[model samples]
Target: MTDAIADAKRAMRAELRERRHLLSDHARETAEAGIQAQLDALIAERDVRSMSCFLSTTTEPGTRKFVTDAVARGIRVLLPVTRNDGLLDWAVATTDGDISEGLFGLPEPVGELLGPIAVNDVDLLVIPAAAVDASGMRLGWGRGFFDKTLGSMERCPPVYAVVYDSEVVDEVPREVHDQRVTGVVTPTRTLTLAPTRR
Candidate 1:
């Protein structure tokens, strides 16, 4: 990545993080509810029998409620476990699954680890992103875990990034390794971007 692109990404991520930190409690609650509804609707629309999702960090758009509800509905949900080698392992989500802080202090499942390939079986993927642009390019947090996962997949399912409504911007910095998502889910709406992957 060029220095200019890297610097741009850092600035964008910092600005977004600050915005999330400043969100009012009421705003957060409202956003969470909206996100849950949008996600539930997406699941139903896609007929997603199995899928992968991330446990939201406090400052990210909330997914815990959606995760719990999906498991309750008998959907096979897999939560990510960060691996030391810059890849992610998967774990089956349970309604009563234990959560513990993993690498980067992100919330992770405390269940039997399913290897990285476990994600290949999913019907869909909902991932975390600092921001996503109109053209579907996703700006992930500095780490490339999701990028690598998406890049390595032989046949990736539809991938969506969850962010606050404001984070869906006109454009964001992108690198060749940065993976684009099929759509984006925000507090107010879900948008399907033009598909760029084969």
Candidate 2:
């Protein structure tokens, strides 16, 4: 990636982080509810039997509620465990799954470790993003784990990035390895952007 692009991404990510940090408690709760509803609808619409999702941090759009509910509904949900090799391992999400802080202080599931390839079996992927552009490009939180995973997938299912509605921006800085998602789920709605997956 060019220096200009790298700098742009860093600046954008910082700005988005501040925005998330500044969100009021009431706003966060409302967004969480809305996000859960939109995600539930997406699951129902796609009839997703199994999927991959991230355990949201306090500042990110809430996914813990959705994950627990999905597990209770008997849907197979795999949560990502960050690995030192810049890759991700998978773990089955349980209704009563134990969460521990993983690499980068991100919340991760504690369970039997499933290798990287375990994600290939998922019917959908709901990932976290700092922001997403209209054309589907996702700017993640400076980690390349999700990008690497998506790039290696032989037949990826619909990948959606969860963010607050305001995080749905007109554009985001991109590099050659940055992956595009199939859509984005926000507090207000779900939008299917044209995906460029191979």
Worst 10 contiguous positions by lDDT, candidate 2? 189-198
- Steric clash count of candidate 1: 0
Report the number of clashing residue pairs per model.
0, 0
lDDT of 2 by residue, 40-122 (tens): 99999999999999999999989999999999999999999999999999999999889999999999999999999999978
TM-scores of the models, in the given order?
A: 0.98, 0.98
Q: After superposition, how far is residue 28 of candidate 2 from its true place, in Å?
A: 0.8
| Candidate 1 residue spans exceeding 4 A from truth | none
Error of 2 at 61 (Å): 0.6
Candidate No. with top lDDT = 2
Writing each residue's lDDT as its tens digit, candidate 1 over 1-198 gives: 999999999999999999999998888888889999999999999999999999998888899999999999999999999999999999999999999999999999999999999999889999999999999999999999999999999998999999998999999999889889999999889999957354
Cα displacement (Å) at residue 128, model 2: 0.4
Q: All models: lDDT?
A: 0.94, 0.94
